[model samples]
Target: MARHAGLQGAGRQRHGYFEHWRRKDAGKPSKLGANKRISDEALLVHIKAIHAEVRQEYGWPKMWKELLARGIRVGKERVRKLMQRHGIKARGKRKFVVTTDGKHDLPIAPNLLARNFSPAAPNQTWSSDITYIATDEGILHLTAINDLFTARWWAGCPTGPPDQESCSQASRSFRYRSANGRPLADNRWR
Candidate 1:
């Protein structure tokens, strides 16, 4: 046991195995009575007040800093623990934004493909979709065209939101010719 504990044989015997065991078994000393500067309940009151004052937008780190600014002496960890224990949380900056308006008067396109993804031959069927990408400059609009049968795709990055011109540009980039050497069907453009 002394060897396992890194204690020399003589030192272990002098200290007594039971005494060493007792000290080792004892857990961390309680800080509740050691520090009498402020009670948790009082600190919690201040935390609640600050939380309300900030409209509940401040998390534990910000809350801790605010408490310090207001002359309240409290540890950050303690504030975090109390806030977590009491279910205090920061609210999101913006409320949910409804991007899509399903009730609009805009004409909805017919589902021509009818969920038939696979085509019998290359250039027989094509699909297109628009998506946005977040970049340091701003949000970039991406327009993509896909040849279903060949599983080949072409993409174009437009300056603003994707529109008819962007789709045409993307299609023109890699438009495969049919048997008569004419552009592929315009169904994908719709």
Candidate 2:
């Protein structure tokens, strides 16, 4: 038993595992070599340059990958720690905007339909709505109208600015269909 204990102690000492329990210098900064400190600063400069070149969007994971591609030997966590320490962070997603404004003193339209979607016949009840769509170019506003009974789409217009006049004009000009095999309403564009 004594021999076994002695052997275990010897193995621990050999592997320098005792250092794990030893106290470190808490007050003073680490005594890194001059060359190491200089290299660390140089790495930080390179990181900042890359961040700016990428429009400051790349986070630590991507930055770590970039560093790896540039032949910089660094860990991902180390890069994260460095970024956090230097106050570097990635941009967040944009917030959605509410396009509707209800604060105006204009006369509010009464809900004639009253959520009664079942219409007696085609064109008996029409529904209109507008929504905004995000795209690569920019936000697109789509205004559309449909018949509640026939489920037929009456009119639709996609505009950039989404003004009220254009939407009303577009819907008003939309005639149902005529022959030449269009729809059913006589659509004559004047």
Candidate 3:
């Protein structure tokens, strides 16, 4: 082929014509955008749009699926690489800690309601409980107060630490709503 192009002959030594191919820098990294078949800008635009649409919750695999769903033809590894290069990461799962502390000095209230979750009238029984949820931010302690009859949230206070203060705040919402100012059933929280 070289001979037909009049560049090299079998008897002649190799010259500058092939220097670009046989250079010592062959294994070195190429400049950015050296490969032009795939435009990084376009792919990045799509990735950014997908990230925004999904609220940055999708990791590489799910992000790749979302991109494919959006009609973008690209490999999963390519999307992974792009996200890594751009420092795009998903919200990680937070470590959860049980907030319930049974070893407390507060006196326990008697279970007057006693397994009777069903209340006959509103405000007759306001049940309260504390629940913990794991979020990317951190552990959140949610104290909820609800009417047993209607099963509606009378009040809810989401706070950190799940301490007695939060429980008091949640109960206050029910207390503030009591129209007759009557004490709660079972004569608690007076």
Candidate 4:
């Protein structure tokens, strides 16, 4: 079309249009690069270095400290700016431990006494268990009878290791409590 207007050679100087396109697209390079304080590679390398040091647990401030220790003459703001640009940060997590064992061979006891914390009266329901306490004398095995209705310890016995007295004490405590009127727990025991 230019040739049709007798301007065949005029359009040859169109290379300057590229400069106009550059100015429009990138906006005349501001004094921005006049101070490209840090190189892209150096900033990324330092960030990765700090991450390796702290296992990625160091934020901008701590990383800044490390940078200073390394004799890097940069300020915290610059570090923060770089880190923010790259979305680098440190955060925390909630700590909880879960433990489960589904392979035990022991039989789960039947809930014969399903949380009957209430008994018609004292000795009507009893819960007994064995625990241990220590004195200067030695480790003592313990057995106790709790009155579900009264919420009181009516009987307790403690003995040293190698003693089979725990079973006997538990039996006697359970008997005495039930003799008052309650039934021996399930009524099928000696």
Write one digit per residue (lDDT tens) for candidate 4, span 1-190: 4423533446634445445556668877443233446666696697788787787798999988888788565778888988888888886653543334567786655676776666676656666655666577866767666667777765556666524565566657667656664432332111
Model 2 C-alpha lDDT versus the unseen true structure: 0.66
Report how far off residue 2 is in candidate 3 (Å): 34
Instruction: Show how many residue pairs clash in every candidate, following the order shown.
Output: 0, 1, 0, 0
> Tens digit of lDDT per residue, candidate 1, span 137-174?
87787877677887776665465765667777776665
Q: Each candidate: what lDDT?
A: 0.70, 0.66, 0.69, 0.64
Which candidate number has the best lDDT? 1
* RMSD (Å) per prediction: 11.5, 10.6, 11.1, 15.5
**lDDT of prediction 4:** 0.64
Q: What would the TM-scores of all predictions be? A: 0.47, 0.50, 0.54, 0.37
* Candidate 2 similarity to native, TM-score: 0.50
- Cα error, residue 1 of model 2, in Å, equals 27
- Candidate 1 clashes between residue pairs 3 or more apart in a chain or in different chains: none
Ordered list by lDDT, greatest first: 1, 3, 2, 4
Worst 10 residues of 4 by lDDT: 181-190
Error of 1 at 64 (Å): 11
Worst 10 residues of 2 by lDDT: 178-187
Worst 10 residues of 3 by lDDT: 181-190
lDDT string, candidate 3, 1-190, tens digits: 5433654544543454355444536863243323444577899888888888878898999988887788666888898999999998887875665545688798876666768777667777776666777799977877777777777875478898766666777776668877633323332331
